[model samples]
Target chain A: MAFFRSHVLVCVDPECLARGAHDVIDALQDELVDQGLIDEIQVLETSRIGGCEDGPEMIVYPEGVHYVGFNADDVPFIVEEHFLKGRIVEKFREMPKVVVDEELGPLRPKEVRIVLKNCGYIDPTNIEDYLAVDGYQALGKALFEMTPEQVIEEVKNSGLRGRGGAGFPAGRKWDLTRQVNDFPKYMVCNADEGDPGAFMNRRVLEGDPHSVLEGMIIGAYAVGASYGYVYCRAEYPIAVETFNIAIAQAREFGFLGENILGTDFSFDLEVRVGAGAFVCGEETALIASIMGLRGEPSPRPPFPSVKGVWGKPTNNNNVETYSNVPQIILKGAPWYASMGTERSKGTKTFAVGGNVKKPGLIEVPMGITLREIIFDVAGGMHEGRHFKAVQTGGPMGGCLTEQHLDLPLDYEALTQAGSMMGSGGLVIMDETSCMVDIARFFMDFTQAESCGKCTPCRVGTRRLLELLQKICEGFGEDGDIEKLEELCEEITKNSLCGLGQGAPNPVVSTLKHFRHEYEAHIYEKRCPSKVCRPLIRFEITDPACTGCTVCARNCPVEAISGERRQLHHIDQETCIRCGICVQVCNFNAITVE
Target chain B: MTAPSTERDIPALVRAAIEKHGAKRDALIPILSEVNLALGYIPGEAFKEVRKQLHDPTEGVFVAESQLHALASFYDMLATKPRGEHVIKFCENAPCHVVGGKAVWDTLREKLSLKNGETTPDGKWTLVTTSCIGLCSVGPVVLVDEDLYGNVTPEQIGDILGRYE
Candidate 1:
């Protein structure tokens, strides 16, 4: 293989591609050959090197200089000056902007960004940007100044817990693996963020991959491990690509591999892509998937700390948990532990989505209530909608009603409120959302994702889903609600893994808060929110009908019949209850009952 | 569009994937992913080929074809049978459903005249419902082949599908 002194990464994002980036690349290559520097420099195609508005951009490294808004004509001068003569062409050079303005609006006052500190503030692909902002300082400190035990003690004092649903203490997990006398221990970073609405881990992995890597290296050093793996989901293609690039760059910089930073510590890691299995997010199942087996969770007695990955001891932590290690090491333990509540320390990043006006990612301290998160951070619900409930966590987590809005957003508090902080997927709902239908939606997700390992999760969840479906379809009997509660109890008690154990949480919590909604659906055969299709009907009122023929023309099932300028009628039997007429109506003529 | 591979190419494709990754048990998922990317689905003959070549002398592990099929069927990304020329995966999770994803989903289904996991008669398009691709901030997301369209409305489904075929 041939080696080059510098690699020039040209941005080929859609915007840049439309702006003649390809012609610029051809010109750069032709000019490099003319200068006899083709063998010395390498050209590579990369996506989104920031400043996409100033298209046709390229970044040259090891100098990490960026040149933007240049066409094919400017390539020769750039090559002649920068590549051959070793002088950066200042006329075309422009610093790369931190391109995260769209994802993260202006940082709010209530937000405390420890894990998200460098997310939008730096160029993710370039290590120099991370290095300038005290990137590997903690790794250097831990490797040279502190002992393995001292590193563990500092993390233990920081009071950090795993951010991946189950809030196990991070330092304790490290110490447990360290206590094991097994050889060749492994540290695994769980980036398999499988929650439906959550993108917190994806954002961190794509934006600041080095931070997670640096933290993993420090954790591996403290735990006496030499190898690590970052298990990222296949859905997040951008994150997996960014993390691979970060790993290659870290290995090239001598921060990874043998004798890192000129110390005796040697550590490295690789990315393991998950194949669309939500169960693989669990620790044991994730290990099994890494070993090329089916991703099914087994009973835990050998816990990963005792027996893991090829039957050797291993340590596993989520991406957010690992990303917190370097900061806890660089800043002292007290400084890191000063924020957040008593039990839960530091900040948590939430992917707040659905119904909320400013639906995006936010990182807030632990004691922040659900009200503050919804109203202050996410800018409350959308116009003309009243907040009904917020579904924190994901499919397995329960729904928090309006009564629980003031509850604090810690692990313990959320768990006490019958919902867990499952990877911080807060999907808000408005008054238009039907509680029974929402429960059915979550049940449908869990039933489909169930691995069918044990009987309760496999059969009981299906049965519960059937009951919920019956209620939604207006066929629920009087005893169906009681039957659902009993099945939920059995599934929660008898399931083997976390997937089965938490499968009934949505139904359990929804029934606890919205029992009246269930009663209305079963007894009166009416959907109060008019969300359940079988129980609701759409009709055109006689007086308000303009008879413009828009609804008749737009109907997919041809359910409406009317003249051009007269009253309209909808065939009740033929209407599919799609609600298209209501959306397309010029006047407020159609109503649902 | 690429031509479909015949049965004769299974061995060579499996061998190339194993050679590029490894013959170890841990290389199974990557090798399967590679083959799936090439052919859009894993043929039964390919599973037999993998079972023949994949072995670990140290661990004394040899995979069975049945296990390979089970794996292929378990993961949502991997397909056992052939799919259409283009696969369109729409988000069916609650985050999208609450934000008018049902209407877009209905529009897509009606436009293509296909249900979930069904392909067109001419094999032009296949519609599948995926859990989520992590773009909930812009709900009602659609993925056609490798291109992602977020914040999709019902009317835009025609334009999005038009760009595919």
Candidate 2:
């Protein structure tokens, strides 16, 4: 109230929009105008007010009062009390408050930030933010400055490969796509991040949309194409919005319109948002999804480059692949190719997640050992827990045990072992996490996300899930393992798309490494980790139980029967194996075994 | 945001272009992007303005923002604002409502400091709740401006906004 009374600024971010921000803005603005207070206070539409946790949140300037949890009915109250009346609405204040400081570690990361270098650093909504950070410098170099053949040559020199789970050379893919004889050729950036625990593409889009755009434009120049599409998942609203903003911004700038940067080349980019389906990441299915059809995979004789995206010659690469293009061109083939193993060059950005100490985004040189990435860079296992296996590259990617920790994390090195670089999702696992359960979790993810386009991927992923769910539910037979193993191959070969083929990866990797866990679930009829709730029984031991009634009341099912001062006992019949009782007893009174 | 393709008005366009973007002839990224977005293309008319905005263009070292290849000028989008017909945001960061995201929903109720079920009274903005925008590195994050706003606070919320009609 110091300057000119109180100011109420509404949150207009997607978080707010989803929660009725638009309505709030509309109602609040009108209320202010109708109340004739427009001149006294200024209601400006600024950037996001950090506390998304306090969604549909509004901040009153000068006073700085936070309001939270508003029903539509509460809008008038907020406006009247907070805005018109200048009274703070205490009931709507959000907790623990969030503040944004520029001094924080890294907005887009400084070192090894290759793919995401410009995400947060630039404005995806403004094309200028992109160009300011050398957005299309590489495109300029590749297009007006260099020939298409020269661009491909630089790619081959860089040794950058496809990031779409396949490790094919990006330059080679461009070469193939370019070789394909057709008009109306197309270039697509696969923003479909289907891998479980993988959101690297979404991050890139949210952070540096123009990087992807610049890469696509360069790729288009290389492949002799005029139109490009980014097939992103609808679940990736931020990425979608960012790309949309980037396109508009680019078009507004000279980068995307006719005669980009004073050159004869013209490229227009449109975004095609995908249904939240895991299988759609596969090139063929992605093409289908882009064409406004069901995301089903077709045979790959011609591949997407020869015939794809409405039967036009197309080059399909995931967001990362396209992301690498501008870097290669801008940094030069030699500079880009300087890192990694002999075969695999450039840095790969991995979404280090799961039971890891530092779960974020890390970009490692290609040849860097997995141990370096996991232990040195990722800060090792969570809470110093004993290292278990890590599930890499999503469902199609296999789990690597401790023995393979030293393996080089390049294209061939990973494939040589068990895992393929299926995108860049790295989910960490600890001792407590059951290997079979992890496999089952992935199977569930794939099964639920399957498009049901082909019999093998649709039915096979479901069947595998059914078997795992059965095993976890305590109905597993010894022979089920063999059947699951066999079905893995059937799905791999029979499925039309990569999704079906890769669905069995988690199961196979787990089986190859942690078969004992499965055997325990089957033959022993016990879960080693005690995580599979149905198989394990929780009980309080007489020796360990300390006559403390703590566990008795905490048990939601009242499974524990105990007197006030005597040793407690779990009613075996009522025990749910939920592990809450075990967790409650600090004295180690309860045990799964 | 959509416009029909404009035919070149070379002299006027170039004049405007020279006036606005010619100052930092080496780098006319940001303003050029804005003007280009407005005018569809940079014309010679803006060169004089450009020369004034970006001084010392003869050195061939323009501010990176003044260049066609400047990164920010191309991939420019605000991360902390609502966009589109309807906005559905998820809190992808960890430590957010204990991963349950119920509080995120609660916050959604009060988004833009506006209450749930309340339209801007103009049918312009709609709000939705999101759980985990998926960047766990920054706990309690919100994806606005196409950006990962880390460690969000409920206090600065009203500041997040857009002029979108």
Candidate 3:
């Protein structure tokens, strides 16, 4: 039992948490504990393993074998046969098993792995799993070994920008606060992520809370601050739970409280729950919310770095930004700066969602192409459906057409293509989708979540919504399209915070890419994709329907009527457009015309 | 009770909440949400109990009703087998009612023979609509205990409730 061999580590990040990490953890623990070989067998639950499209992910430590999208039912065989009995779990393994010559250690012929080395290979919740792969060694180095100026200098050299979408220099932001004429300054981790389809913060917080905490402590040292705050959304109970646990554990381990690592520097962190406000994601509004004011935006001359959070010099970074701090401290700046594109350095985390073959969180080098993600990494669109456009940057982000699929996803490139890497929310859409409707859908989301503090965002977005409604409802005016462009410009220029400024991007980009579809909606009263109910009609193909009685019985509006063994016809006028009939019908008879 | 005339001091506002309703965790949700809206987050000492000054031990008055529900029959999930004293679930999604989900829900209310969000005199059942229950697919879905009932119907509603009790 004490005889040593190789080890296997699997990441159980929450995204994959649902996919089957719990069972994996349970199995690994049980198997090891049962034989009393628990001390010899090392299993880790690291952060998300990044095979969202094909993952209930696992990794083999010492050997570095990766299996993507595996089920725990496959674990026993993997442990007994692959690890112990000397056989591989072929069905569960992610890629083709490479055979080693027995002389050379098992090595991948061609595959690059960084930024996610610890992901899926260690237990993120356990500090020991993190430390086994050398987690807090970075904090120990930065705090006990390096000077504050040197820590800042190393980060300045890393070229890691704020992953919260703005891509500001992480080191410089710390440096500014460090040089500022302020005492009792604060370092904050911005976990109040409100994007509709984004959960990167949740993953980092739940899977690797210590990363962000370690980052914050280093940031506090660099900024000459004594306190840190993690403003997380109260909606995310799991994230909050893990963060609370991480904080208590870190403090208990002598990492977060006064004089960390036996140094004179003292730093403490507190978790503030946000009452589900979307606008509070904005830095200024977040400060206001923390200051016991409504989470509303105010004009800024005093940025948070200058006079923020109780009017003190504060360094605020997204959850991902904080997660990177321990890395830079451990790996050194040059190592961190080595990855990613020129302007946007290091790997970026993307919540790849929607109509893609693989819809989950992925962390790749900054300049990775959308084509590579969708076709290669994400395993292409689901069913090979004609890939239309991908919407990056949440509701406020713009949609890029198929032509731009090859575009590198850097901060500047995405913005130039009509979407910034706003919090890295990538919602991929397919051919069956209507771009006009997609634009309207995102606009409706933003309008509802808008704080309504400024006129342009408040009123202009409403007017724009009314216009999109007019277009979608088949009542668009001839000049309406031009006015939408005008309104977008006005709203962007006049709105107070980033929400209003970027709210119009969805409309503008969709219009730019799919204007002909809008023209069809106006001139021909036709929905090119035939998706809009008002512009299309459902008909039972005479030859296909066998009068099964399913459609006739299921229609909410009683739109269909048919006798047994007779053809069914839809009463168009009575139809409420519910489409229940279509869904209930197993036949190919129902067609939208 | 009605948000303090649109402008009030923080503690006075909390006191006003206490006047309308006693300090309690069950009371905490509505009172805290309102207070947080008026002022971001509950103040440091806001958790302190509010004492009622209007009625002394010498005299007593009838308790105030929350009146959260205008039409009780509209809530179907409330009518099911009365589990606890009340049914409290928030709707955190869209299109619950747009597809006549609300109307279908109302049928459950009528079947349960109760008004919106009212407990039976036995203090057994109270049904209420919420902001958005996140499971949109099964939406207009009701969560009774840990179980989620999706695409609910009035006829089937009673059968599910029978098991809960």
Tens digits of lDDT, candidate 3, A1-593: 45556565667666777777788788877876776767777776677555455666777766666777667676666677765676766776676455532111222222233434455455666776766777678888887788989998888888888888788888889888888897889988899877755666776777677777878888888889998878887656677888888788788888888888788989997877665567888999877766545578888777888999878999999888877878778877878778878888778776665565545566778888999877776557767577888888877889898899888879999988888899877777777778888888778767866887899998988888999999989998799999999999999999999999999999999999999999999999989987777988889887789889999888767888889868999998998665667777888889887
Q: Which stretches of model 2 miss by more than 4 angstroms?
A: A1-111, B1-133, B136-165
Residue-by-residue lDDT tens digits, candidate 2, A409-475: 8888888888888777777677877788778867866776676768888888888999999999889
Q: Note the Cα lDDT for every prediction shown.
A: 0.90, 0.70, 0.71
> Judged by lDDT, which candidate is best?
1
- If scored against the real structure, what TM-score would every candidate get? 0.87, 0.68, 0.71
* Model 2 lDDT, residue A51, Cα: 60
Candidate 3 lDDT, B1-165, residue by residue in tens? 113335646568767765554544223333544554454334333333222322234543221222212111111211212333435342422223322254456555765667655556765555555433323323356755446676565456778778757
Best by DockQ: 1
Q: How accurate is candidate 2 locally (lDDT)?
A: 0.70
lDDT of 1 by residue, A146-243 (tens): 99999999999998999999999999999999999998999999999999999989999999999999999999999999898899889999999999
DockQ (CA atoms), all models: 0.65, 0.04, 0.07
For B1-165, candidate 1 gives per-residue lDDT tens digits of 224545448888899999988878787898998888888887787888898878545667678888888789888888887899999999999889999998899888988999999999999998999868888888889999888888899989888878865
State the number of backbone clashes in model 2: 130
